[model samples]
Target: MKKIFFAFIVTLGIFEVHAQKEFQGMAVYESKTSTADMKNQMGKNKEITPEMQKLIEERMKGMFEKIFVLHFDRSSSVYKEEEKLDAMGGQGQGGMRMMSSMMGGGGTFYKNVKDKMYSVDKEFMGKEFLIQDSLPQLQWKMESETKQIGGYTCYKATASKPVNMSDFRNFRPKDQSKEAGKEEKKETEKKTNFMDDFELPKEILITAWYAPEIPINQGPENYWGLPGLILEVSDGKTVILCSKVVMNTKEKATIKAPKTGKTVTQKEYDEIVMKKMEELREMGNGPGGFRGMRMGR
Candidate 1:
């Protein structure tokens, strides 16, 4: 069995280069999180209710939605869903509304915000790192510790940023009068910080593991660039793994970069977007109450 496993890994190392290569493997990681409710802002004196806890749990579950085993070679991407999402408006208001409806509004908005607000990628040092295009910042660091998963080795990395639970609040627009509605809409338009509340790995940990023999940057989601193939990844509370790995299959694996958008370096695009977001936030204040949802924030 050990020899069979060894041969399987060796086969994967050689032929998984073609985009079509069917390299089978599993990736894993842990997920931990905290949730806050704006409605509960009434304060600590109020007893915590089971209903609220359920809501929080449901929200947390959604926040950890990407936990799963991913299968792909150099040619495909673990975040194929996101690739498809790019066709849906590039994370703008339209994207948020679509996501909120699919996730079931309320708690869903907060969770979805965190998921799309930022992008996490594996770094040149083989460590998982986070990019806050919203904040236009990038940093990499080692995670908490290592673990053995499904006969593979793994390492952990964490970031020291701040997490804003306030993002959990629902920002839909609310207007009582017809004139008020139009006035409010025009005033709040373009002032929403829909992306600010939903960044992942704010003061969180991430783990990534690669096969020492692969010597290529690759992993699930946006993670890549390790000495070997990454088998598992996680933030302190959420985990995702590659469950089955088939190395060096009959077909070849080919990888390609995304062709959409105004092709710019990640850093350059982030800076421009971050500056734009800040300008929007400063220009106007969005609705104050649970306003009705708008197409763009």
Candidate 2:
């Protein structure tokens, strides 16, 4: 009886050690936006022929489809795009690179749920910015819906997120009422500003599917605050889905937040981007630029 008791105590100690081990995981996600709407919108334009539309579609395809990897521990995670070479063996096309900057791609995002803060290393128009901000408080409404993704059972949760009007992904064709058409004609007569017609919805609904078995509150991009790890997210136009998940890899990921670049809050970062875009527009309109280029014609 004494020998059996000693063995039981040793077994319990080993189990405790295993239980205390830090949990780590890596998730690969494939993000893609539906181009059908964009194509349909562009098809209405008389200037864009079928061949030109196809070329634009191909370019936009590269901009919309991206792969991201999330390396996460129990309390923190780092998410970044998986770099890939372009067709011509260079980094990417100039147009694609510009689209990436406009879409805020190619950034290292770090989130610490325990500390209730997040940081991002973003480069825009040749300027690097470190955006440090508090985690957004999403009032998620849990649903009874369930689905299987990559062999894991995921539950649905949803919330409303404020839309950024400047994001091209959120752009929708505005309904042209008779009164609005008259106003638009008047503005056109006055040579309306190129940026005046761009519009996006005020708010967007976010749907996320989280896997409770993972038990981490981390997610791709700026999404979080769920009871489990978010495996998939959709914001109407774009969908990010987990393609693979590996648990407890041999090498633990370094989950340090980015420290370089000009530090600014998220709001300030948005303001800076908008201001720069405005400046560029002014420069383009000034001298020997793409002066006739306009949106919402």
Best by TM-score: 2
What range of 10 consecutive residues in model 2 has the weakest lDDT sum? 287-296
Best by lDDT: 2
**TM-score of model 2 (CA atoms):** 0.81
What number of backbone clashes does candidate 1 have, counting pairs of residues 3 or more apart or in separate chains? 48
lDDT of each: 0.39, 0.75
Question: What does the lDDT come to for candidate 2?
Answer: 0.75
lDDT of 2 by residue, 1-297 (tens): 999999999999998767545668899999888777666655654445787667555655666888999999877889988887775455344435545645536778899888999998877656778989898889999999999999999999999998653356776546657347477565456432323433577788999999999888889987999888899999988899999999887787787899989999888987886676678666754101223222111
lDDT of 1 by residue, 187-253 (tens): 6554233232233333544456556555444565445545566776554333555555655545532
